[model samples]
Target: MDYNKVKEGISLLLEGLGVDCNDPHFKESPERVARAWTDELCIGLKEETFHLTTFPMTSGDQPNMIILQHIPVKSICAHHLLPFIGEATVAYIPQKSLCGLSKLSRVVDFFARRPQVQEHLTSDIAQYFQHKLNPQGVGVIIKASHLCMEMRGVKHSGLMTTSALLGCFLKNSTVRAEFMALARLQ
Candidate 1:
């Protein structure tokens, strides 16, 4: 993305919102926001590579669920241009392939950097694993706080939104329940 152009746009937007650009506190806000977008808030732009490998089945040929829980997620809502901060829980039953434990978190980070809806984001991660890993099943759940809702619109600060994608998880009640139970664990 064009960082300079974005910085300029933020400056213009702040000016339009009647924020004093010359004020000491506000003068550097635009640039700082732009840097945050390019670095932290939008780091998914750099995650274009998906490294996959085939590993020998070490789980004794039993298709056990692999769950990664409470992965911190932060993204911008496409509709409101506001922050959506949350935690994601993902699970998949490997068929004959498996990915590194950390790779799952990287995949989550990859999609979270873009502006998106929570529903779409949840489904995208599940779909990616299903398609790429060809797993027996994939599940994704996200619970997030949208700044758009908390700061404006209804202004309900305590409201949290949840979205989930259940592929094989839905077809099998036991698997679905297990995934949910693992996700809720502290």
Candidate 2:
């Protein structure tokens, strides 16, 4: 929200890194990075962007499992301020209501845009739909490769997987199994 402050801070960071801001190529770099962070990476911090509209189920509507898979996950690692890229699978069983199909992916993007650890991001998205929809259950699974780990210490190239299950998804083995199967998890 404070564009000027962010620009100033990024300028200071460039200076601390011994980069000359006066250089032709670097002159606008601070403003550009600051704007990119606010407009892209930190967009989720704004509450207005999280509005999820739901539709009521009719008598003809049957309660069933709904799964959205291969939803892209792009987030910054909170610890090292690096990037993590992956996909997420979100599933839930209806309980008298259903949200738009695209809303599931929007929810994922909402949390992903914030600087966060994969674990918390998984849990937050699960909790959001669980609380908002009061569904029979909610399940979330994420698989991502973090730049922090890949580009630094140990330099190991490995994917990290995390999952969160709530309500029936947590209590019922069959339900959990089905979700994981649909998500293509081993």
Candidate 3:
């Protein structure tokens, strides 16, 4: 992230908006915004920010549906560059391996930290597991309330829901039903 560029741009923006850049309260605002935006936009894009680990499924272990719900997500909407805060429910059936339980939440956070649309974010989370673990099926659902929608035009509170179903979750009704049933338990 180019902190200096962002700082300069913010100063220019404030000046254009007729906000006094020399005001005491506004003096460090540019630097503060730039520093805060670094975590919101840049940190998650790094490859090492979150490392996923999977455990091999044993011979006797059953390939059951594993669902983690209420995983909090905070993200910047690509369209408006505003915030959307929500919870996600992720479910997967392991064919050969299982990801750590806590990593499920981490995965949601990992993807949500970037500027995104809820649809693509849902698909990305499911696809990442599909690519990495080669799971039997993956299902991801996110429910978010976008600040852009409420704080801008329309100015009404609403929750946006999006989901991505892959493999068996896409091909089999039974698996999809089971995942939804468990995931909606909250």
Candidate 4:
């Protein structure tokens, strides 16, 4: 990300909005926004360096779902560039391999760092696992509160959006139910 470019854009945006950029309080706002974007909102770009380690399968040849729930996600909406914050529940039934628990979070962050719609984000994670692990099943669910909706437009409070992708999880009702049940619990 080009910090200078973003700073310039923000400066112009503030000027367009008729905000006094010369004011002491507003003078550094552009730089600060650029810094915040690089540090917090856009940090997922760093995930390209993430590497998953190989580990022995512990499921003893029985395909079992590993569900990680409530993984916190904070992202910017592509349409409005406003914040979208929420939880992601991910599950995969290993075929012959499994990733470390923490690596799953890294995978989530890898995709979350980019500007996205919730539907695509959910599907992307599921597809990543499907391609990488070729797992027996992969399920992903994302529930988020979009600041664009809450802080603008309709301005409705407590509005939440959800999206999901169920792969092999879709073929078996019992597995799908179990995944949903796990996501709902606690």
RMSD of each: 2.3, 1.6, 1.5, 2.0
The candidate maximizing TM-score is 2
Q: Which wins on TM-score, candidate 1 or candidate 4?
A: 4
Instruction: Supply candidate 1's per-residue lDDT for 84.
Output: 90
List candidate 3 segments past 4 Å from native. Answer: none
Could you tell me which residue pairs clash in candidate 4? none
Report the poorest 10 consecutive residues by lDDT, candidate 3: 41-50
In model 3, what lDDT does residue 69 have? 93
Per-residue alpha-carbon lDDT of candidate 4 for residues 95-164, written as tens digits (9 for 90 to 100): 8887888878878888898787888888888888888877888988888889998899989867365655
In model 2, the runs with Cα more than 4 Å from the true position are none
lDDT tens readout by residue for model 3, 1-186: 566887788778888999886899888877877777775665576556456899999999899998999999899998998999999999899999999989888888888887879999999999999988899999999999999999999999999999999999999999999988887787
lDDT of each: 0.84, 0.93, 0.88, 0.82
User: At residue 22, what lDDT does model 1 achieve?
Assistant: 100
Model 1 CA deviation exceeding 4 Å by range: 22-27, 58-61, 158-163
Number of the predicted model whose lDDT against the real structure is largest: 2
- Give the per-residue lDDT digits (tens) of candidate 1, residues 41-128: 8777766775655566775777899999879898999999998998888889888888888888888888999888888888888888
In the range 72-114, model 2's lDDT, one tens digit per residue, is: 9999999999999999999999897899999999999999997
Instruction: Name the TM-score of candidate 3.
Output: 0.93
Q: Give the TM-score of candidate 1.
A: 0.86
